[model samples]
Target chain A: MLIRKPNPIRSSEITSKDNYLNRREFIRAGAASGAIAGASLSAPAALAAVIPDEPLAKLADIRKPSPFSTDETLTSYDDVTTYNNFYEFGTGKDDPHRNARDFEPQPWSIKVDGHAENTGTFHLEDFVKPHTLEERIYRMRCVEAWSMVIPWVGIPLADVLKALKPTSKAKFVAFETLYDPKRMPGQRRRVLDWPYREGLTIAEAMHPLTILAVGLYGEVLPNQNGAPLRLVVPWKYGFKGIKSIVRIRFMSRMPQTSWNLSAPHEYGFYANVNPEVDHPRWSQARERRIGSGLFAAKQPTLMFNGYAEEVASLYDGLDLRRNY
Target chain B: MNINTRIRYVLKPLVFVLALLPAAFVVTDLFEITGRLGANPVEEILDRFGNWGLRFMMLALAVTPLRRVTGLAWIARFRRMIGLFAFFYIAMHFAVWLVLDQGLYLPGIGEDIAKRPFITIGMLALVLLTAMALTSTAGMRRRLGKRWNQLHTSAYAVGILGVWHYWWQVKADILEPLIYAVILSALLGHRLWHRRARSQGVTPRLRANQGAG
Candidate 1:
């Protein structure tokens, strides 16, 4: 597999490294966008309006954009949080937003094991703190032909994988989501083989663009938005970015993903966002951006979700149409 | 006039208004006044219209069985109206999908109807419904005479295709579509049971009237 060097200087040139590191300055910097400003100012008020007496104090801190972030306009906090397809929660778009309200994201632990030197169950906080957090504004395209541009706050998956020190036998990385059927009501029904799973080639997992996101729109990850931890593979379809992650296993072979297992002919293992290759059910040539309202025309989908320049080399001569 | 005549006069207009309400809600949602369409309004609109189309089809199918069960002959009068309304909603659903969703892209819409199994079934339902709708008028019914009933019987096939289309489109959470399937089966079952009973010479009051007439 071909490996490409991540550009470290990209973030440094975008903003003053010192100011970007300071949480306060970062919040101020992010306030320029109308969506982020409205989100930061109104989140507490909105939450308060819903639950009049409860004090959600932690919501007051706004997230600042990292130097590595994209310049795309951010989708509104309402659209991002409300319109979700987290099948582990439910199949309806708003089911996750409604059902995940009582889900407890705290007291979380992630197991990092299989073909790795640093193999152990670690507390979510300890595992996250050692790496620098960055806000990457990415275009998330779903296999359902809908898309969203979200400002996600998290550490790169490469940083985490490098810390784990994978052995030579680790040819692929597989992820598993939490499986408590009681907490996750959708799991009660076998919508997907429970404990939703996803996988990537070793090279794809180590790509600089792959992130283990913990938050969106600057607040702590909402329960519905895969609270505590989630993967954000910008180049692939949104299902590849599994949510509420609990385990990461490095294996010698490509692991079966939830959708691919359910319908192999429709959903492929690679799942790279290629517009030319249509899903058996629907066309992927264009996608309707969430929150763009009813009258707006659809935007054409980009190859590898517009990250082709960075990650295309990984699939050098492979036929994307067949692999899809 | 008697109370029955008074009710009959008001019922048609009331049902007409009631049938138009779903379309009105869709229009308000399209304008974003109610904001019920949520993030993906096109999908929401398409889904709502399709849902109403299926619901109207079910209501149309229920008319014959309901009239026989209740022994209310007046209920049979509204059957054509309800069936026409079903055609209206399905047409709206197809229009939104073709014009708004597909952006008037004829080739793509044709390809979808021709290729995708669910879309193919849905289009078949629409075509069957259109034929029923066209032959529904009093003039056309008079001209075709006995053949009209045979053509309209295709509505049963339309209902089956509709429910199947709904069942096939969903990725998971088959609960809603499954409910529709059960209701449709019960409706179809009632017709079959009655037909069997009539064939066995066990004529109920309603069947006796048809036999005598």
Candidate 2:
């Protein structure tokens, strides 16, 4: 005998005329409120939505905003990540965002060798474990006359160099980005010499502000924004901050930077942001802030990108115009 | 109405609208109705204007060659309009760079034009285009007489300079500029080939109003 109980479908679940009308009205009200919320918090909400869903547990402790942060509004994370000049990805501004989706950044290793006491290839996780990550909100000025305020998460390069114990002969620190033609389609083009390289003088590398960044905006760094590890020298042009670093070599002589090798006259090893000296192609006296609306006025570029008090003394005796 | 009359009345106005469309699109994008300009709107605007300017320059240069090949004399009538539109876009590009990018910094603009190789070449092309546009009127053409043809012939040089400016400006991924270079080379090559053939007394069949003046 089938003693089938009545199905336990709730009245709310059933599409009754009164309930259906009420549900539609509720949905309409909800959508209207959402539109209002979106309009009011345009920048931050848009940024939050675009931040990739990666394991951000490493950033748990270092998520607080830094004291060193500028009062200037931070550029949205979407703009910082999507609009990049990582030519290894491609030349187009949005190329890195579109092309680097499948890039394998996890399970990465960095080879730390050449003129260092502790010269060995180490897992990226192991390298990052020792240091206390700190948040640094920095004004990133590009040689192309654009700028952004980035929230970077990493230990200072000075601290990392201290661990390595660079030999006295190590006068410069040379960094190399990963070279995988299959992963990086732009590598097939002869736009730059393969294995993009950059170097900083030992003094510059040891500067307190110089960071070996691993994350941004309270998340694991996006692949386009140099996942795993990268150098961030806020006082210099954005290109000086090499991305996707795989090798860190301590060289005795000034190492050849990628752009300097390609166009020596135009791009110098010391790419410090200077308004007085202009790139032959354009003036550097002003810069358009990224993520600012089209009609927004260009801001006057500060000397050393407003890090003049800290970094200007680094070049006190040196002739910037001549070096530039 | 006759074919010539139909082209002058209808086709000419249509071509004018087509020529003006790119600029109109840029304006609409500026208003954010169509968020086509992306994050860096100033750069996008500058780039789009420059692109249209270069494209119009190519079209203007293609007219004579296309007319000769197709035996369509009416095509030659749109050349002045196309050339003027090219100048218009280039001027807008320069204006945006000056006002929006440079913030009306006259000295900086001067320095860039004087110092930068790419800017120098681009300014030279603009100067040539301006001269051609000013002399485009029938009265001015008669006033300059034979010299008018001589001045207008510099459009070939303008085309080369325009392409060179584009090539020099790019940091990498030069495929776009390379395409322009190839097209310019082909157009110029056709002229050279035809000249050589004519010199050899081969009297090509498409010879109608092919005189240098």
Candidate 3:
């Protein structure tokens, strides 16, 4: 329910007394120079150019260099995903970033159950290490009206599932984020359900576009945004890319996800992030990117976050609007 | 002098300190952001202020009940300051959310409220708090008079909304908000029971005299 789109941009170079309008000597400068207007809008880019050399050098070796890269991505551990769009984490964009700091992710473990060949638990680190970190600049659309371009670091979910070897009967791969009432102070109320469950079809989980990320923007994941580990499905609503995962199960039947089960009509298991399938409440056509130029408007959303060419095959026969 | 005046004298400084706390927190938050505060300073600063608002509002609402139960009528003297504290921090909270987070965009902020029921309720609680804060003064109380009691009684409604507002806002692991909600419910229940007892002619003095040693 938290809406986090890109920040709005306005091109205003003149730091005159009246920031709102054009008048006087400062106005003379604005009148004298149209290029300064454009230059001022590029400030976010100039700021983006500066980066700490640490996280990039320490990039987890498990992730592969992203096959698709974009210069426009908001790449940083804290910026890309730490500020979540999860309503369950409080309706504020920064709530997850603020509230999740207390979580300790090092000693974590994820249980793999159901139709998976391995019914045992996997250490969080070990599980994370098998996959390589890639910088995937993907468009993340929230169920609430907003969007962001994130440079996520992690390997394909298929790479992890390939090692697990889903049993022949496995039809769906269900994921569960850590639901500790202790760390996630939000669990005091029964808003959706504990453990914040989500699921993808086995085929969808194995799709190359579905990633299990450890961190993003060359830094450790922030606690509020499901630090330690989370999923990144470019084609699905951001909720499907759950945070702070603790359990993963491959099931023969479609799994019961928290939101879909809570409100079948409002949220479906597919939860694909499709602009065509508008939520009953609001339009999903446009998105705000974080740190947009001073004068730029929010950009339009792409189908499958521009990963449609890669992920369209998975949803071929399904009606996204009906299933969404 | 009566006990009421004595209680008033004690509460004056206490109320003054509590009243100043919300502003102090805002100043503290600004100071912390200057990079002077300790680790996890931002969250600490935000919570310190936000929780102060919620607690102050609850205490302000408790004034009427406290006055009735203890017969210390002067306890009403502190209600305005406490209610205003609630408004002060809550407004600051909203400001922080809008400026720091959303960058003051109307459409994006509106979408968040509409999509998230939790946010909608939280904002609604703020609206109610603002109403209570504006009407908390003696001038409004006297102007409304009998209507004041009826209108001010909306505090109970706001109290419930506040608890739900906090509860709805959490993402996962909701134990803390639930605890807050339960505590508020029990406190409100006590007042309701006390009111019923009063209407039923049940006075503590009657019990005391009947059971005298």
In terms of DockQ, the best-performing candidate is 2
lDDT of each: 0.82, 0.83, 0.65
Q: Model 2 off-target regions past 4 Å?
A: A1-58, A63-67, B208-213
Q: What count of clashes does model 1 give?
A: 1
Using lDDT as the measure, what is the rank order of every candidate, best first? 2, 1, 3
**Mind giving the per-residue lDDT tens digits that candidate 3 earns over A232-301?**
8877878888887887888888877887766676788887767666665445665556445322455667
Q: Point out the worst 10-residue segment of candidate 3 chain B by lDDT.
A: B204-213
Question: Per-residue lDDT of B122-178 in model 3, one digit per residue for the tens?
Answer: 788788777777777768877877776666666777777777877664544466677
Evaluate model 1: give its lDDT: 0.82
Q: Candidates ranked by TM-score, best first?
A: 1, 2, 3
Q: How do all models score by TM-score?
A: 0.86, 0.85, 0.63
DockQ of 1: 0.36
* Residue A81 CA displacement from its true place in model 1, Å: 0.8
The superposed Cα distance between candidate 2 and the true structure at residue B207, in angstroms, equals 2.5
Q: Write the per-residue lDDT of candidate 2 for residues A1-324, one digit (tens) a residue.
A: 222223222333566744664565456446555754675585444322222236343365573466666767889977898898888788899999889888878777677768998765566765665576788999999999999999898888998898989999999999989888888888888788767889999999999889989888877888898887999999999999999898898999998788887778789999999998888677788899998776677888998889898888888799999887
lDDT of 3 at B84: 77
- Predicted chain B of candidate 2, TM-score versus the true chain B: 0.95
Summarize candidate 1's per-residue lDDT along B60-178 as a digit string, tens digits: 89988888889887777788899999999999999989877878777777778877899999999999999989988889988987788778889899999999999987875789999
